[model samples]
Target: MTATVAATKAYDISGNVLKEDLRDIIYDISPMDTIFMTRAGRGTAKSTTHEWLTDTLAAVNAKNAAIEGDAFGAVARTLPSRLKNYTQIARKDFEVTGTAQKTSNAGMRELMAYHTAQASKEIKRDMEAGLLSDEPASAGTSVSARVAAGAEAWIYAPNHISVNQSAATTTAPVSGFATSPVTDGTATAFTSAGLNSMLQQAWSMGGEVDTILVGPTLYNTISAFTGIATRFRDVGSRQQAQIIGAADVYVSAFGSHNIVLSRWARATTVFCLDMSTWEVAYLRPFQTVDIAKVGDAERKALLAEYTLVAKSPMANTKATSMS
Candidate 1:
């Protein structure tokens, strides 16, 4: 190909006037689902140290019959055991320069506004992970931050099951509000046997297990289990056929459980929970506030102070050491 002699070309010109072809929307693929947080109940906490009480009735005795017309005798009444957890503060903040705030952006009008929205989602993800973690509770000092025990910490004794751990044993927290699983042992595949055993234990303790939370790897393994309830979906003749490959609800001798995939759940653990027995106690609800300007920049913070409440630890179970 040949061009005309001394012809002006677009590339030959400098500082050409042309509009940029930038999209108006921003695409973010980060996950934002908070399964545990959304499913758990909500409550209010008045102090940094949130407290709750749990009581149990006396075990059934076949010889509980008393002699007819016997004189009444005073018996000591059992009192509830108190449990407490420290409230933790989670926060996310961002700052925008004065010039950046005033400058035009491709996808958003103001940078600060977009960052504030992002902070909210980030904090939520953090809370979800924390609530499901094995971190122990701590009554922090001025230098250290307080920490609330998580669901894994509350599960103990009969409710806690060890999978393929080296010692075939799991440690329980000293108290419902302090300490955590001392060891994770070894990792292995999640099995139906482990799951059923935990469910049975929880049921024996009067737990009404209704939900099962698992990570991605375990989620897929659970779907392949033979025990999953059979699912049949009705389809119209004209409509395309649908393939059902995943298991959403698992039915066992104990009860039917809703199987949920958690993006932030621990890879080696699964939680069998009675939603009614769990709560998120908030001393201070989520709030956004503007920080005082230091220079020619605007600052903002997203803050929340909350604690995990295991209303009835016996009503929940944890399966650990699953790779």
Candidate 2:
């Protein structure tokens, strides 16, 4: 009898079902894994509890930054079902790395691991280098960066950040926070084809995307699709009806949703924990991810995404004594 050899890592079947799983992953992200700000008056509700996320997003990545590509400014507003398409962007540039449930390894899971590895590397490299506004030190090298602290693009960028040997002016989490003039993105005409197009654009860039900020109308349109699980397809009457049925988990999360989320100031920033949705446990301002000047371009790459790398480190900067 021949023994069947198994692959150490597996993936989540890479299709529509995997797409649903991806949405679950994001949804399952479980809101920052740590201490969160509460609505001032009540002080009871744990809204965006980003436990150690303060450090993760502040973390960095390893995938070589492509100069001719998006260069880190590749955020998009699209439907949730389209998450799968955006993942393929890392095929050549970076790969993910992570741990698992010890027993179960699936196809989609393998893919996720690759993405994680890339993210971790990015965080490590960025942390050591001061956050700067430039292309990663290298153009298309295979070296991954670490997670550190500083801000190039914000929102997802860590709140407590410094620039060019400057002072830090990190953003605080929004409790009763509200954007000045809430303007909506392309939320009016959400078509099935449009969602797919948008997802493809993001994936082709670099899996550097962390969140998809959208308006209520756009959120409604995305939440309206389901059934096929994670894949994105044309939404017809019957399809939307089926997809809407499977959105119970997602819809429930948004039940308490208000119009305030959509009102983010175009220029104003929001506080974000830097660690992964999971790493909320061991985050400090200058811990884990650290920044250093190794050489020329290598250090330059590290500097490009500082806030991304340092969100979790708890470096020299001190957290406002939550007294």
Q: Output the number of the lDDT-best candidate.
A: 1
What would the TM-score be for candidate 1 when compared with the true structure? 0.93
Candidate 2 weakest lDDT stretch, 10 residues: 82-91
Model 2 quality (TM-score) = 0.21
Candidate 2 lDDT for residue 171: 38
Q: Write the per-residue lDDT of candidate 2 for residues 1-323, one digit (tens) a residue.
A: 75455743235355434544333232223222111111111111121111112321322568856778555666654422110000001111331222332324444455544444445445533322223211122212246433221222222213222222233333332321111111222213444343333333333322222233233344455456442233334667755443332221221111211212222211222222222321111122221223353432111111111112223222111111111
Cα deviation in Å at residue 190, candidate 2?
2.8
lDDT, candidate 1, 64-175, per-residue tens? 9999999999999999988889999999989999999999998898999999999999999999999999888998999999999888878876567776556434355455
Off by over 4 Å in 2: 1-187, 208-217, 226-323
Task: Give the lDDT of residue 103 in candidate 2.
Answer: 27
Question: What shift in Å separates residue 309 of candidate 1 from its native position after superposition?
Answer: 0.6
